[model samples]
Target chain A: MFAFYTIYKGYFRTALIVQFQYRVAMLIWLLGGIIEPLMYLVVWRTVSEQQGGSVGGFDTNDFVVYFIAVMLVSHATFTWIMWEYIYRIRMGLFSVMLLKPIHPIHSDIADNIGYKFLTLTVMAPVTLLLAWFFDASWRPAPWTLAAFVPVLILAFLMRFYWEWSLAMVAFWTMRIDAMNQAYIVVGLFFSGRLAPLSLFPEIVQRAADILPFRWMLSFPVELLLGRITPRELLIGIGAQLFWLLAGYLFMQLIYRAGIKRYAAFGA
Target chain B: MYYFRLFATYVRVGILGELEYRANFWINIIQSALDLCVALGGIAVVFSHTDTLGGWRQEELLALIGVYFLIGGLIRTLIRPSMIQFMEDVRQGTLDFKLTKPADSQVLVSIQRIEIWRLVDVLISLPVLGIAFLRLGASLGPIESAVFAVTLLSGALIIYSFWLMLSTCAFWFVKVENIQVIFMSMWPAGRWPVNIYPTWLRAVLTFLVPVAFATTVPASAVSGRITGATLIGTVALAAAMLLVSRWFWRVGIRFYSGASA
Candidate 1:
């Protein structure tokens, strides 16, 4: 544990400096992230306004707040391991990571955290400006705010581990872009990125509940929005915990299998 | 004829190169289907709540989605993949090989690399477009069809010039690949009518990114939402942009040689 901590520390420090060096690229990435939720915000806001100030119980201001919260939460839980793995495998860069004594995920996790740390500085101001622009009116109870932290962390872990396992598909097929894209499309809908869960069709919402995506993104946003009841919050957290463990185990299984394949064929 | 022959040669070469990777063919189909789903799903949800969004009826919006996939297919089929290769060539200083080629460097770079399977998006979108038209119970009169063809041509020209201009920036700016990526990042906005966006955002989508012309204008022509003035403006813009990008390409080539000189 001590050695792992030290390795992560070194990785975090180095990745932070590298991330800062490519600050312009980071800004472009940040722009893409901001645009998604902002697009939904506009669409739903239009819907709400056209429907006489409310659609599916969310007024224009409610939508503004919901989407803004979603932007932050989605940003917090976002994982790029899919693209990262695909590129690394294609470029033969993963061999370096494979040879390292430690598991590669630690460095990826460290890099992801480092990136979020840098971008959150910009995200805060962007969110504030958006809230101001759209007249956001959302105030969670103090308890809701307190509960949000653990839920967000759980969501992040669940997303990272599952996606990291998905990334391991590159070991079997160097071109997993199609698989990755399908996963992304699923997440885009099921995770409430396109719209809030309440607004979706009944069957679709039921599928989202069964899938892990809702637990990863929408649950935290709903929790913070005070839209989730206590029973639902308990159930969501339980589902998140379940997925988190499942993803971790899946990652371990895939890692072992992938590494065997890698050693047999060589990266 | 020369350019067409060159493009044909490149297409044959690209197909031969990818023949071993049959998995790519199936993967591309899945990816294209997934793209259509997200687009259609978003429209489904939006229309479920309201009859019209920004005066675009349900079928019209569905047609917009079809056009989105169609244009996105054209982009991926040639422009994006080639530009990516061009960007990498610039980064690795391998663009010299293209510069030395006797053919026009612009045409050579644009057709050098092709992902033949990405054209599935256009194929898939045809049925979607047909269904949308059927649902609307609208037949495209010959004039409207002509206008659509012209607008789509203009749209394609505009995007080609826009992308080429952006790619040319790599001549001076080594890190302009991410700048190229910014186009795709903003592309989802074109999945809907740009009129739904706020004024400033609408302007950005229209003037800055040209998403309006690239996807919506062509669809609008088909849906009869396009006025004569907009069609003229689009053609005029496409022509101007094509010339400007060609001029900029020459300037960049000169700048590239001068710097090394």
Candidate 2:
């Protein structure tokens, strides 16, 4: 445990320095991130107004709150490591990473957190601007707000593990574009980026519930929006825990296999 | 005319290169099919709740989506991938070889790399377009068809110019790849009718991104809903942007060559 802490701290310090060096580039990337959810917010708001000011139990204000919550949850949980891993492998950077004494996942975890911290400056302002422009407002219940922290942490870890596992496919195959596209398309539906899972068909919603994607994004957003009932919240937490364990185990298996393959093939 | 032959030769090379790996073709097909499905699914989800989105009927929106795919495919086939490669060359200082060639630098940079796989987008768009036309059940007059074709060409020109201008910024800014992400994020908004967005967004799409002319204006011409003003405006914008991008490219080339010397 002490060794792990020391490794994490070292990684974090390195990441902080790296991120600070490219803060401007990080800010530009944050602009891209902010625009996607904002675009959806505008589209759904337009739809709601056209539909007599409500759809799927969300009023205009409710939609505002839901999307704002979505913005934060998505920002917190999202990982770009899939693309990073692919690029690193293609460039032979991963080979050097594998030679390090520490596990590569720790550096990635540190990088992700450091990036989020540095980019939050941009995100906060953009969120504020969107809220101001769109007149978005929400009131979270005290308990729900309390629940959001742990749920958000679990969601982040679950997503990080799953995407990291998926990125390992790059070790075995250079043609990961198709797999990445498929993963993103599925994620758009199941992770509630396209719409709330509640608005999807029953089959889709059920699938989303069973999949890890919902726990990665929508569950925490719904929790913060005060939409989930107490029973549902408990169930959501349970699902997140199960998926987190599953993702960790899957990552371990895939990492071992991918490393063995890489060693054999000399990537 | 000479450039067209060069482009054809590049395409031949690209096809030859890709033909060596047959599995890539299947992978490309699956990726493009999934993209088409996601687009159609979004349309289905939206139209489920309403018959019209911003006064665009389902068929009209479908036509817009077809135009979106067609134009998007064309951009990816030539403009986007080439500009991406050009930007990388600029960053890596490999553009010097192209500068030494007898051909125009702009033409060479614009036609350097071809995916060849994006033909799947072109192939998929035709059936989607035919179904939309069938669903509309309206006979297209010759004049309207001619106008649609003209506007479509103009729209393509405008998008190419816009992308060129964006990519030209790499001469000054090495990290212009982020702009591609921003462009794509805004592109989903164009999948729906531009009229559905608010006035500010509509203005942005029309003037700022030029996405309105790329998909919506051509789609409107196809649906027989285009105003005379919009048609003329699109043509004019396309011509102006083309000139501007050419000038910008010249300046960027001069700067790049100067810096290298």
Residue pairs whose backbone atoms clash in candidate 2: none
lDDT score at residue A96, model 1, on the 0-100 scale: 89
- Please provide, for model 1 over B108-198, each residue's C-alpha lDDT reduced to its tens digit, 9 standing for 90 to 100: 9988988888889999889988887777666567777799889989998998999999999988987688877789999989998888888
Superposed Cα deviation of residue B245, candidate 2 (Å): 1.8
Error of 1 at A132 (Å): 2.1
The lDDT of each candidate is 0.89, 0.85
lDDT of 2 by residue, B1-261 (tens): 998899999999889977888888898789889989888887777677666777788888888889998998888788888999999998888888888999999999999998888778888889998898788776567877888899999999998999999999999987799787667767767787788676887898888888888899998898789999988988998899999999999998877753354
True contacts kept of each: 0.72, 0.40
Q: How many backbone clashes can be found in candidate 1?
A: 0
Please give the TM-score that candidate 2 achieves against the real structure.
0.94
Q: Write the per-residue lDDT of candidate 1 for residues A1-267, one digit (tens) a residue.
A: 898888988999999999999898898888888988999999999988999999998888888988898899999989899888867776778788878988899999999999999998999999988988787878789988988999999999999999999988988887777888988899889989899988898998999989999999888998888988889888988999999999999999999998787632334
Interface RMSD value for candidate 1, one decimal?
0.9
lDDT of 2 at A202: 91
